[model samples]
Target chain A: MSASYSTHSQEKTQSSVFRTSVCKEALVMDDELVLRQAFASDPRKGCELLFRRYYTNLCNHAIRFVYSKEVAEDIVAELFANFWYSRVFDDISTSYRAYLYRAVRNRAYNYLAWQFKRTDSMDAIEDMPVDPTLKPDEVLQYSELHQKIEHAIQQLPAQCQRAFLLKRIEGKKYTEIAEEMQIGTKAVEALVSRALTRLRAELKNDWFLGLSGLVILSIL
Target chain B: MTPLPKDILFDFFDGKATPLQRKLIEDWLMIPANEELYYQYLDEWETRHMQFFPPLDEALTQYRQELNGERTRRVRALYDPPESPFRFQRWFWWSIAASIILLATGGGLIYQDQWRYSTYRTGFSETATHRLPDGSTVTLNANSVLQVPRFGFGEGRRLVRLTGEAVFKVAHLPDHQRFVVDMGRGVQIEVLGTEFVAYARNRGQHVFLHKGSIKLDLPQGKQLYMKPGNLFTVDADGHGKLTETAPAQSYLAWQDHWFYFDNTSLSEVVQQIDEVFGVQVVISESGLARRRIAGNFKATKADQLLQSLSELLNVKITRTNDHIELRTLTL
Candidate 1:
């Protein structure tokens, strides 16, 4: 980073954390470097700094899997708490962003799997992994795709967006979604179907998931 | 099938891929282009995730507390401090004495800031009226505080920070400088020049424009162009609704110590009494509390209002300690 970057992050945390780095320039170091240094010296400060850096992004990523804010928060909180409790500093082979993002994604999937296990057979999602590979380029691509999908969803009508979210993200059935949204079952289905068709069309050029993948994705 | 079709990536994500398909997909992900495509498929499946936005501030606050809690427990365990109640008592009194000295010195330093804004407060049954340097008049209600800029009144932005309730009759500047009221809690009222009755307390902030138009700056970056009879109410949760036509004069009745309630619930009237008199009032009867009362009364004391309400509603008002209780009158 540039010379101004350290002063910038310092300004961000100035009101909260007391600057402890005797050398002023060291405080402006890269996030991963600071995390490693802090973890080697003081684990608590390292954890807090890491939380500040990635908490929002991780929560946003978790919210993608489990629609509820409170549930997503619980997943992220557990991920962080587990990281500290298990002392995963020695295991951080990749970048901190990759490690944290993968952690949040795994925990979110576990939550979804548990939700599905309650209603259906656990065998449907038996091979869910806890530590998926999160390469830097893959993370960037997914983030961009996430933004594009978010924009497409935003283009939907207000009620349609609500109904579609209730069905897909919250995993509500047609009848349950109808009752919650005060719409008929047919209307709920139509809205969700419209959202799916619109999303497929919007992502057609960018999607590498050819015709068959799109069909399968829409089905299950 | 060497590179594995992209369909296998979806099957892999869904946990339905066969062993051979999974191996092919894993091998494909080793290449950067295939990995990007794989992540794009994953993002497509999560399109609904953008609907709800979870604020990270509250989560981080909770996390900070947990971190501090763990650190405190670890420190206590490592130190094994002595459990001496007497020693704690001695240190507590010494700390109290030190705090008193610090506060005495701090008060003097605060009074020396003549250039900064100063707060004007009113106690119970006491109202304050002040004229600003820009010829604007402010009438602060009882148990309220208004902080106005001391030195820079007419220069830049004519700004005043308010809490509780106040009525402002702002003066119009030749230069057309805007006057703004920053009612903490993310609520701000801005105007070029206008007269308005504003109430901002525990419940929420309400603005009733008396005359002239003003632009209200809402918390969430929404601006409201309010007319003369507009009544804008924003609750603590930032949920706002504006009533286009309002009894704007009735809102300013408190300036003269006269309250006018037209079909307003007794519970709401009692809340106003609590705010005006700064007292604890308990209504025992639920029906009586919900009863819509319409009348006008002039009273500055809680006892006077209670006496008027007792005759008007045919209820018995009794004082028990500092609390006033209202119950149905027995025949």
Candidate 2:
């Protein structure tokens, strides 16, 4: 599904460039200039334009790390709200898009850390083994984390891997996955739970410790 | 080194960049402007390969409501006086009528006593700073009243009656005169020269010493000496406890329009908003009222605080007239 979407996106990008037939960098610069001018003249209009321009992109970018649609949207919405209320645009030297993306990335990292701490405390209560040295913000490398997650998913048992992928990636319900696998819903839940535990164990030794745990927890 | 082309950066984003190209891009990202460019490109890439498109119209509508609420609050703050004019006028007429009746009934002593002491008051959502006759400064929090005797205020002893919260900075005199703040319920704070916060409300009485030392005279004839960071609190039933490790600065944050809460429950927070800002908040769900939050929030107006609370808790807060309701978002 993602492969076909990416192909279609490539075609759309090429067509957009051909239709404009101008330097994309110049267009981006012009947009920034206009946005700055709007902010200088009337901040409300600037806020509207800014929100419209980056809300979707910021949420999409944030979902890469947080792995939850609601959380990603919240992260972006909070960024926009704070930007407007705090008047951050007045002193911002960087483009609004850049500042927003960077801010959202940092917020997403912080959210992950908070989640890890909450689950870590719960794990302590349950006497589960937890890695203490793992710090998401310190060790977060986007591409590397993605590769590590993919690698860990591949190492799961075949049925467990299928159940996990169908649940986490495709966002299918337990009942749907059970029907697809010709199993009961309870069996599907057990398979997914086992997959999460094994993935956490598999990724713990590689310094991607609490983050992968949080990623799987977010699915739940 | 020459800047990496846009295609190479895109390839890096797509996890297809060579090791050397990735290394070069990482180095280039060290520059701040280059970092901005990096995000701009990332924004473009995500736009082209969009995974999810949020409901922009709904978000815009929410944003507009927040903005409108803030603007109306600012406008109201600028134009609205602390108390309604008609209420003040009605109170003035009733006092005049009562004073005439007292004179007619030959009850002049009580009226004379009212004239002997001057009172300082802060209306709802308002704080006031006043310099007393003794050159000491007192900053009264919202909805507080302090009474100082007009005649011979700082002669042999200094004493004042307080209701609600205030911070006092007592000026030292060469004559070694002591200042006493008489909070009702037999709780009095005595100090030679010190800075402390006294909170006397329907709930209880509390005194936090910021500098110097003070003596708290509690009920049952018990007395406690408070150091710079000591917090003496008495409940409504006059049960007193002293905390030595209280964060003194957070207690003073309210003077600067900031509220500091440490794992405070939502119900208690709502009660504080009622006291400090005079805003009525109703949490729809009983379970939600027990949720605890810890943070420092800055809000000069009621709506700003409400907005921050809603955002922090991911709750939906709606205001109708003077009443505010909080509920969990049903998404």
Candidate 3:
């Protein structure tokens, strides 16, 4: 098991990290240099640095899925401990941070999916994350934008619009869209392009980017 | 001659094309239906939720502490063997070794973790490719950030929170993956397996399906399955109206860095340039803003875009610092 951090820090490690600026920087860096040095070399400094590196980002990321600080913090601890004890990160080839992030995302999603089924009920937009920091105006804006977007989608041309939605919204491939639509790839591109053109015209090609940047955020 | 690979769709978007390669895509764009790709991307970019989401500061802080402590403990154990005396000198050596590691790893700063934070007051631009536990791939446009938890995904269903617009290309899983993209306005898109482009922004949002299928659960609780070539429209109330025959290519053109203003007015063009370049572009004479324009320009900096407009409109575009001033240039 390349998973290290094997030390027994599993004890309620408590959230007393100094919240040093260094950890913040490390958190910001891709998990490349850190993970590569996991076993091949010493990264930043030691296990503490690893904690400092990923602690907050992991916690924030995990909270979106888990809804419990205790669980979130524990996940961070385990991830760091594994990186240190086994240097499993050393085995990773892609962005170390990406790997860890992917891991966390998967864990969180699994928990959410399980929780969803246990409730025996599914609500569209269920448990909408109402961040306290989000002002009422922003919340309103998100809803307004959602409605506007729906109308915009309705305006797209028939074949082109269908192809665009199938590819972009459903997460399918062109071949899939083509096969489903029983048309060529060229047809799919047309659907997406035409749909977007109508939307651009509707918005008058105005401040959509600004609106989206603010409202569209990490749901993880 | 070898045919261009499938990447032309993306290569054109990123500006990595060679001259010959560019010529092909450009020529392809001229085709009536082909132009749809650009229009679609433009609409997609316009409405994506690319703006900032509230920073989760406090939660991030606590997680850091926990991870940091675990790391520190491991290092302590590695340096101070069980038999080694708990002497001051041994402890001091461990501290020094630890400090050395700290310096080598960049103090963990995520240098350029992403492109510049947000595009200037105009807006920041970013494109992200996400690999879901379900093995599917999703891409987010600039200014749009989709959040996913650290935990892994499970069977059948996959869920995600999307505050912004994104293009999804789902990789098929052994089990049919149930994919959901949640855009906050009570807009939830649920699909089994397919590909599509979703553009969501303030004032309006739209979706163009290129392949497979999708089920949209509107804010008002209406369930709509948008079939191939079937366009779906919904208002804030989730009341959906459908249409057929939408040319979908335009839905993705923005990815090409190509902005097409077909018979677009001057005011609208300038407004668009301002947002894209993150700089203020003011038409010196207010009347000129209403003038109509017909042509295509690079989806690039404000200056380049303005230059193209000036040339075609037979006008002069002057720049003072980042402020763009446009006026009719006597032919």
The most accurate candidate by TM-score is: 2
Q: Give the winner by lDDT: 2 or 3.
A: 2
For model 3, residues B1-331, the per-residue Cα lDDT tens digits are 2233436634443334466766675555443223323323322332342222223455345334435542232221111111100112222333344345434554233111111111111134445565554556677655555544222233224566665456777665554556777676777778877887776655356677879888888766767788876666555454556777566655555565567766778987765554444567778676788888766565545566777777777788677885767888765
Worst 10 residues of 3 chain B by lDDT: B77-86
lDDT: worst 10-residue window of model 2 chain B: B78-87
DockQ of each: 0.06, 0.14, 0.03
Question: Pairs clashing in candidate 1?
Answer: A6-A28
- Give the range where candidate 3 chain A is weakest over 10 consecutive residues by summed lDDT: A10-19
Give residue A103's error in model 3 in angstroms. 29
Indicate which candidate wins on lDDT.
Answer: 2
Question: TM-scores of all models?
Answer: 0.42, 0.43, 0.39
Interface RMSD of each: 21.0, 17.6, 22.5
Position B256, candidate 1: lDDT:
82
Q: Which candidate has the top score in DockQ?
A: 2
True contacts kept of 1: 0.12
Candidate 1 regions exceeding 4 Å error are A1-220, B1-116
Q: Whole-model Cα lDDT per candidate?
A: 0.63, 0.68, 0.49
Question: If ranked by TM-score, best first, what sequence of candidates would result?
Answer: 2, 1, 3
Model 3: interface root-mean-square deviation in Å: 22.5
